[model samples]
Target: MKWSEICIHTTNEAIEPISNILHENGASGVVIEDPVDLTIDRENVFGEIYELNENDYPEEGVYIKAYLPFNSFLGETVEEIKQSINNLITFDIDLGPNQVTLSEVNEEDWATAWKKYYKPVKVSEKITITPTWEDYTQKSSNEIVIELDPGMAFGTGTHPTTVLTLQALEKYIKGNETVIDVGCGSGVLSIASALLGAKDIYAYDLDEVAVKSTELNIKVNKVQDAVKVKQNNLMSNVSIKADIVVSNILAEIIVRFIDDAWTNLVEGGYFITSGIIQTKKQMVIEKLENQGFEIIEINELEDWVSIIALKK
Candidate 1:
């Protein structure tokens, strides 16, 4: 069998949404190669940091590679993906070079190619995300390891936004708190919340694929009893009052659901938001403040920002 490798030269800001487009178009696997990964000083406190090849990354911006089975409808699917990606600009997302190319590859090569980019990394003080294929043991009893199969999903929980969100979750969730994970891609946050001692968790995502992906991952982490997966728009018709509401999505979408989030949280409950670029940080902060949320902490990783706000 043969697979077509589609590579897109795009910006960091566009990674999440563009990856969603590819996933929607039936991409088998997605690999993101960012030059920053080669230069960033990762703290290998409890896990091994895999070596990255400099030549595999783009000189500017980033390359998103996806594999799709070569078939008769391949051309049409690619066009749909291109159009969907181009539509992102209306949301004020920067597409960068936005150059896309394709190549032919054998099935076996592309099947495992994306795995090399993944490894167990401690995203937060207590949480380490490793692919399901890796064997990771906790160096300390306090350390939490999340097993994820990210090939069928959008996020592997290693991105800066996710890391920041996970770190905030670790800090806020003491124990027995009810968590609402808005836009819970790959169900990583929900699983982390459960592992960190949240008694009950409700995970929601608009995309059916994401909903399924989160469900699968939650079971893999053996947190199914604590986490409930749902397919719903962000906080829409969600009346469950939560101790903490965490969302790792676009800033534009995050601001739209401020009221919903407010209503869904108990008084003094927390709202954790990420997937916000540095340029949009002020906008999100202002929105949260205007909604009567007290900004507790704003952390940045690789120019990506995450905010922990208290609903006072």
Candidate 2:
């Protein structure tokens, strides 16, 4: 089978949103090549050695690549992706040089090429996200390991947005609390919640691939009993009141369901939201506040922001 590689050359600020656009359009296994990474001083802290080739990266900006099956609709898919990315500017997101290009590749080549971009890394104080194929051990007694095979899911559990949400979950989740994970891509948040001592977790995503991926990942992490994966549009039909509701999705989509999230949370319940670019931060904050949620904590990592709020 043949595959089409869609590569977008944009600034670091646009990486998260562009990656999301690709995933939403049915592209799988994204590869991010950031020139900044070539200049970072790793110092060997994570036990992984870096041997980067400067020529492989763009002279400026980063390149995000994803693979989609070569089909009759490939042209339409690519155009829609471009339009979605162009729409980001309205939210005040800075997309530098937004040049897009495509190429054809063999299925075999894509199967292994994207794996090199993933590795085990500690995203928070206790959580370390490791790909299913990597070998890693806990460096501390309190360390929690999350094993994931993201497959075609939107998140690999290591993105800053996801990391921020996990950190917030660790800080806010009390034992035996019920948690709802909206847009539970790869089921990482729900799995993390269960591991953090939540008695029950409801994981929801509109994408069928995400639903299946979450189910598989929950089983991989041995948290199937505690986490339930489902296909639902945000919190639309969810009727259970939860102690905490967490969502790592676009700030625009996050605002659309603020009322639903507030309605499904018990008094004093927490709402943790990430996947917010810095530009849309104010819009999301205003929506959460308008829904009667008091701002509790606002966390930022890179260009991403996570806002934690409490029901008033």
Clashing pairs in 2: none
- Candidate 1 shows a clash count of 0
Residue 189 CA displacement from its true place in model 2, Å? 0.5
lDDT of 2 by residue, 128-153 (tens): 88989899888998898999998854
State the lDDT at 104 in candidate 1. Answer: 96
lDDT of 2: 0.90
Candidate 2, after superposition: displacement of residue 17 in Å? 28
| lDDT for position 34 in model 1 | 91
The deviation in Å at residue 260 for candidate 1 is: 0.6
Clashing pairs in 1: none
Per-residue lDDT tens digits for candidate 1, residues 31-98, read 99999888888765323456777999999999999988899999999999999999999999999999
